[model samples]
Target: MSNESVRVVLVNTTHPGNIGAVARAMKNMGQSELVLVAPRSFPDEQAVWRSVGAADILENATVVETLAEAVADCHFIVGTSARGRRIPWPTLDPRACARQVLERRNSGQQVALVFGREDRGLTNEELQICNLHLHIPSHEDYTSLNLAMAVQVVCYELRMLALEGSLSSDAQSEWDAPFATAENVERYLEHLEQTLIEIGFLDPVAPRQLMTRLRRLYGRMNLDEMELNILRGILTETQKSLHKSSTAK
Candidate 1:
């Protein structure tokens, strides 16, 4: 798996020093791409100082205003979450998460490993943007982990897998098309919601977990570009038919 295909993303980080340390951790694991989403502080001496010899990583990091922008081009996204939510996502331990990341990378997919803020971690809405959720499996007495520490743990697993060279590369190899990017998936979901509303199948006024559940279902499918296009075409046809029926009436 090429390290260039795997992106380490930090979202809404409060400390520049932590960002520096994360870059260091990523560098130690042979990773190069770093993305920062709405960091509270950056380009600070504290961050450069924390990076030590890894200052080059900081120099090339991409800073964005939102998580969507940080991973829009990425096809596979993994978000780090420490706590359980009302609707449990497909949670993976650090090792499993690392394996999945490498597998996707080997299969020619752009993958993003997303880390959240220092204090609160990723919001539920942010976590929902991810295709999979990763948990470090810390001890019950002290489950909370330092931001850099959490990153280091996952990065270490990735490094070990890369060094061993045991990961299978057959995943999605026979597929005719590439997987849909995160941005395209978001766009398709928006299109789906609009069609559902047009058909009176979903009530926006009392929208509960319908969209969330649909997102989960689609995320699990790992839909390819062709599959997504086919689904979108069906939605468009359905919309056109509804418009025609309304005009006739």
Candidate 2:
């Protein structure tokens, strides 16, 4: 199954117990990969105690210094938050989120379902790294969720989608190009930002939200090799035009 390809990423997780509980939830859902980004406390006694039989996940968990490092190789990234952002992200409720993950996983692409910190959730900059945002609908008056509880709910939806035999796909895409990895797309965004600045379309000194919003938009496009090449060619031509203008002056 593609379960092994689904990575659960915890960013800036503070509570050791919550991390352990997340491990248990992931194990229950058959997801083996767990990435912890700058967690406050891990390998704690409380976490081990809470994990019980799922301590293997905690022991095998890959800890990184940054969220980018955590999901660098993933082809699809989904982040979770309790509230909305000022510039809304492409979102899916738990059900649609599961389907998207499963589809990408089935297509042999690694996917990361990211959970944010306990108190404030993912920062706007971190959320920009994601392709999709997900929120679990809860009571309107009191919507706060414990970190582990949110993990459990998302994991449960994933497990249910698998059990229900809904993960299959009949549509065959003729394109052979693989979906661009998150790292590659990130680099592409950097190139795009630089080109835009060179073309005088984007003021480098006051970029504002231009790059972030663009990243959010193209992050979901799942650009293939041909598409990426075409985009880079356009950027190359734009740069050539800038060089020509400078030579003329």
Candidate 3:
């Protein structure tokens, strides 16, 4: 994985200091790209002041209107969320998530790690866009992590993974396989959901909850393209079988 391809994004940050601290964290881990989506007070003197020696990151930071714009081209998107919400996305520890990101990265895919607002963290809707949710394990009594600290933890893991080459042998083997792509997985997911809806397994009127759960379940497994295609084929056959049964009846 190229060190230059991972992007760290802060969404709707209300604190300039946190933004500065995030820049510092990214720099500490050799990460350069820092993107801010709709931050409250950018270009504030305080942000630069807090950046300290990492001013280059702050200076080169990209400010955008939406998170979608920030991560549109990224092949992998991971969202940091501390609190478990109603959404069904599978949560991963920072180390594990970093491994998954690095694997996709080794295939020459651009990856983005997204952090949300400092106070409330990411919204359920925002979390939905991410392929996975990353949570930092902390003392159960006091699990709320400062936004900058969370960024630091995630960046630290990524830096360590990149430097140490901890990838499993299986993962290394898949690195050479060109059969499955992220786009294929996404299309297969869409087809599976449609099949579920058609088979009365999903209610079209209130689909978000179930789909979110299913998304989380599948995201946790991190299915490669070939696996995703196999799943899609199963769904297609099931759909055909159901159709035949209804016609015969």
Candidate 4:
């Protein structure tokens, strides 16, 4: 797997030093792409100081205002979380997470590993957008980990798996269609929501967890490009029928 295919994403990072240290960790593991989402401060002295010899990583990092902008092109997204949520997402340990990332990378998929702030992990809404959740199994007595350390743990796992060469050369060789990108998935979801509202199936006033559950369902499916287009076409046909019915009435 080419290391450049995988991106390390930090969301709302508060400390520049942590960003620098994460750069160092990524450099050690042969990963070069870094994405910062709404970081408090970037290109600061503290970040440069911590990055040390890996200044190139800091220089080349992409800074964006939102996570959606950061990973819109990525086909697979892995979110890091430490705490439980009201609605549990599909969770994978570090090794398993690394394995999956490597496997996808082998298939020429662009992947992003998303990390949250130091104070608290990813928000429920942010985590929902991810295709899979990654949780590091730490001791119960002291579960808290430094932001840089958490990133290092996951990066190390990826490096180890790559060096071992345990995975197949082409993980998705048999699969004919490419997986849909994050942007396309988001569009499909928006269309689905609008169609549901138009049909009076989902009351936008209350809404509840219908959309969240649907996001979870689709995230698990990892729908390919063809699959996503098929779903979108269905939504379009449904909307047209609704329009026809209203006109007839």
Candidate 5:
């Protein structure tokens, strides 16, 4: 696993000590990159004091104003949450989430794992930006974990995945390279929605929630460039067929 492919991001962290501890945890796992989004007390003397031998991580950390800025380059994002949200989204355990991250990294994609504030966790808006939600299994009665502890657990799982080499026999082959870029996927999605609209699959007046669900489904697949092209071609052909059918009628 390329060390630079995966990054750990802490958003709105309030405690300087926690930040230092997180850096230490990441270093212990042989991971170096750390990003801070709108930290409350960054570069603080307390933080530097606590970082100890991992001070290099603190010095090299990218401090950004917004969460989006911190993760804009990342192709895959996984957010950690201890509680279920009001919205419906598929949730994965830490190990499963780590596997997903590894797969994306091995495919030469940058991935970001986001951890929210220490006090309240991620807000609804922040959670929406993430493609996957990860939760560490714990005792049912008291599951709220310290921010540093949460980071440690997640970093540990990711490190283990990296060390283990291949988690399954179905490891990605060279042929499974990304066929399309992020921009290509977005354009294809737009074209798909337009085609669906033209075919009356989506109501013009009041479109159903199909597109959002489809987006989520496709996001989970992390479609490569070739797979995306195939899907786009199918959509284009379907549109042509619809046009012919309309002309015939």
Candidate 6:
């Protein structure tokens, strides 16, 4: 799969100039897809000025209303977090995150590396939506980093992974199926939860962390399209069975 399948998504970005720099960083690293989610300001002169030679990335960027819309089609999503949240998440450093992303991309999966707003980073809700978390190891004394700089660091790691040719000729000999996108997995999860609720397998209100835990499990599995669809079909059939039993009763 081409690196073009990897998208760089910015969520709730506040600075127009930062968006430009992010585009530049992505372009330099051979990633071209740019998705902007609710930027405070865009299509502004400063963004164009800062994009410099990466005007194409800026020009072709897709602006969306929410993070969900931005990554709806992605198979894997790596969200960047500057700090830990109350709800723990599976975390990886920049290099490791890049490896996982490239691995998915090599198998023909659409992936997204998401960056949050400059001031607050990603909210808990936003982080929960991602498959995995990536944190840049910075000095404890001073961890504050500009949004663009963080984008550059992550992009640089991806660039290095591309240069190293991590998926060598030997790896290419194996059949790599087209995997399900993150969106597909997410949709299946929703379908599953709904089916369970319909059958009284899951409580409707205050579901606790059951779905969250299940998401973590599936994310680690890196499920392909066939696997995901099979699971969803099982849920559908189970729901149909429940309907038939109720009608007979």
What's model 5's lDDT at 238?
93
Candidate 1 lDDT, tens digit per residue, 52-159? 889999999999999999999999999999866889999999899888888888878999999988888999999999999999999989987999899888989988
User: What does candidate 5's lDDT look like per residue over 1-249, in tens digits?
Assistant: 574347899999999988998888888877888999999998987787777799999999999999899899889888988766888766898889888888888788899989999888888888889999988898999887888788888888887887775555445655557546778888988998999898778986787789899888877787888788789999999989988998999
Clashes of each: 0, 0, 0, 0, 5, 3
Estimate the TM-score for candidate 4.
0.65
lDDT (Cα) of model 2 = 0.85
Candidate 6, residue 163: the lDDT equals: 72
Clashing pairs in 1: none
In candidate 6, what are the lDDT values of residues 14-104, reduced to their tens digit? Answer: 8899898888877787778899999989887889888889989988999999999999988999898976688878999989988898888
Could you tell me how far off, in angstroms, the CA of residue 35 lies in candidate 5 after the best superposition?
0.8
CA RMSD per model (angstroms)? 22.8, 22.7, 21.3, 22.9, 20.4, 22.9
Worst 10 residues of 1 by lDDT: 163-172
Error of 4 at 20 (Å): 0.6
Minimum summed lDDT over a 10-residue window in model 2 is located at: 166-175
Considering TM-score, which of the candidate structures 1 and 5 is the better prediction for this target? 1
Q: Model 2: how far is 199 from its true place, Å?
A: 98
lDDT of each: 0.90, 0.85, 0.85, 0.90, 0.85, 0.86
Q: Estimate each model's TM-score.
A: 0.65, 0.64, 0.64, 0.65, 0.64, 0.65
